[model samples]
Target: MRLSAYFMPTLKENPAEAQIVSHRLMLRSGMIRQQAAGIYAWLPLGYRVLRKIEQIVREEQDAAGAQEILMPTVQPAELWQRSGRYDDYGKEMLRFKDRHEREMLFGPTAEEMVTDICREIRSYRDLPKILYNIQWKFRDEVRPRFGVMRGREFLMKDAYSFDLDKDGARRSYEAMFRAYMRTYARLGMTAIPVKADTGPIGGDMSHEFHILAETGESAIFFDQELEEKSRAGELTVDSMNQYYAAAEEKHDADKCPVPAERLRTMRGIEVGHIFYFGTKYSEPMGAVVQGPNGETIAAEMGSYGIGVSRLVGAIIEASHDERGIIWPEAVAPFKLGLINLKSGDAACDSACEDIYRTLSEQGVEVLYDDRNERAGVKFADMDLIGLPWQLVIGPKGLAAGVVELKNRKSGEKQEVSLEAALARLTA
Candidate 1:
């Protein structure tokens, strides 16, 4: 991709409406545009990050034995009625009517719809199954704020699992819990899973995965060991949930005596949540399977959800620097930004072209700066976009058969032979 032809409309100053750091940075970097009070049109750069996060979530869910499926964003009110939640869901549920004046609603969540689907396939052989979808959900937020972090309409990756009995349901929940830990670890984050209330879902067991950030809405308290695991890899389910962690609502002062120094108190964003609800929806919707004794029983059920679009804002809140977003390599829009320090200068242009071709041949995603902008502007844009590597090809460095490689995270720069830089990057 070439910057000259790209549609990155960066701003010179922060938007006054953006109150939080993540919200401000997202606007300044031209990642998204506001369409309405709590809605946004994701720009190209923002869409890329959203898709990356969704793909990671899908991969982890698949690895945990969940099957993927697509459900409608708009559902009949009868589905909710069957679950006995049509009126209890509160104002957040956006209800409407179709052309025929039939009561319908934009789905805030898919519990009822999924339950209806499972009831159709009920049988002993189909006793257990996991179904998932990555789609947009609509919620009439009373007051949406903080950019995509709290939007009226956003993308969500939700999954539902069915099992023959209570024990099987617990096992399924554990598998998803493990998968969430792995997903967060791969994104260079620590999602502290804390016990939580089931709320309207009516479940005996529920957990919320919160990513600690200074600008988050929910205050969080966790043990000191969690900080060490923040950077450590190989996080198993036991290791991830070994220490005490909870949101402010769940904090118990008497039982958990985390020393002042050992306790990490910070605002945290809720990125993912898992709940094991035994027969909550199945019983109401008649999602029963026949047993060996020829008797029917409601299937135990669980649901897991990841706020796919909100993660983009949450990640920026947790990981970005003063300059702009510092995307994890696994989710960065482009791996490298090739900056031609003297764009249009024959020598610098030639060197940049050669390097861009080499990287492209290696199947690397590189953004080539072919625009005739000043060197300082180009440098700033590269930092704002937050590519992992910045290959600087100035005429002065090219004359010496060397180019400068700068690390986005460490801010370290080194002058090396062109061949050596390529080897280091490709390796």
Candidate 2:
């Protein structure tokens, strides 16, 4: 995308309301704008990143054998009532009434709705079905803070599994748990599975995927070894769950074998969660399947969720540098940044255009900075947006048949032939 035509509304100063670095950078970088207390308008740049994250989540879910199906944001209150959670869900649930004097609500989660769908398609033949969606959800937070980290209205990717029995539910839950690990790992995040409170979901097993960050909510005590290795890549449902990882509430000091010296304690942000709620929703809503002997049984079910939009903010919190976000290649909006350092210089402009064209032809996502701006301003904006690789062209470099190659993470610089730079970037 050309920066000249792009609608990135970057700000020079930080907003007072933004409390954390990610929040501030998101505002200053023109990624998001607050429309209300915790609701945001994802601007062009931010929307691109959000879509990229959502796509990665979708790919992983599909790979794990889950079917994609979008659910409604607004649901009938009758579904929540059948699940016995209308009043139990408390103020966080955004309850409302339609103009016809009928009860309605913006769904905070989709357990009830999904269960109802399963009941409508009842049969043992369709014993195990996995359905998922990427949609918006609303929770009326009493004190909305920290930008998208704890927003009132946010985008989320939630998947639900309906199975014939407890054993089938366990398998479905494990599949999602494994997929979650891969999803975060692709984003260059080390997410530890911590036991979490199931609350109104009412489940025997629940786990929260927490990304360790200095500015996290719950304190974490975990195995020191997990920090060294990449858990996200080398994980699956078959792996033993005997690891010592838990949130503060579930942490048992005596049972944990990590010596005090090797133990690592830090705060973390919960990015994903999975829970196995045996017959909670199915039984309540009559989501039943028949056995071979003709006996009807409530479907065992599980729900898995990844905060899709929140990940854009969480990723910044985990991997940002002094300038701005250092996006992982898998989730970066663009792979290469082409800067016409001397936009007015005919030679430099021609070289940048050629390189940009070559990269584009090679199927590379390049953000060409063609605006008439100072070299410093161009470089700063390039780093601030954190494209993986930046190719800088100037009159001096173009005259010598070379352009500068910059690695955003290490701040490494090299002057190479235009052909070599193209090879390196497109490689």
Say which candidate scores most in lDDT.
Answer: 1
Model 1 ranges with Cα > 4 A deviation: 227-242, 252-254, 259-261
Candidate 2 per-residue lDDT over residues 1-427, each given as its tens digit: 7899998888777799999888998998888999999999999888989999998999999998999998899999999999899989999988888999899999999999989987875678887888998999999999999999999999999999988888888889988988988888888888877777887788989888888887788889887766654353665444435456777887789888778887889889999888998988888799888777899989889999999988998888887888887888877879988888778788877777787888888899999999998888888888888888998888888778888999888889999998898888877
Q: With candidate 1 superimposed using the best TM-score fit, by how many Å does residue 289's alpha carbon deviate from the native?
A: 0.6
Query: Could you give candidate 1's per-residue lDDT for residues 1-427 as a string of tens digits?
Result: 8888888899878899999988888888889999998899988888888888989999999999999999999999999998999999999999999999999999999999998888886577776788999999999999999999999999999999899998888888888888888888888777777778888888988888888787788888898787566546444445655777888887887878688789888888999988999998999899898887889989999999999999999999988788988888888888899998888798888788888899889988888989888989999988887888998999889888889999998899999999999998888
lDDT of 1 at 152: 96
Clashes of each: 0, 0
TM-score of each: 0.96, 0.96
Give every collision pair in model 1.
none
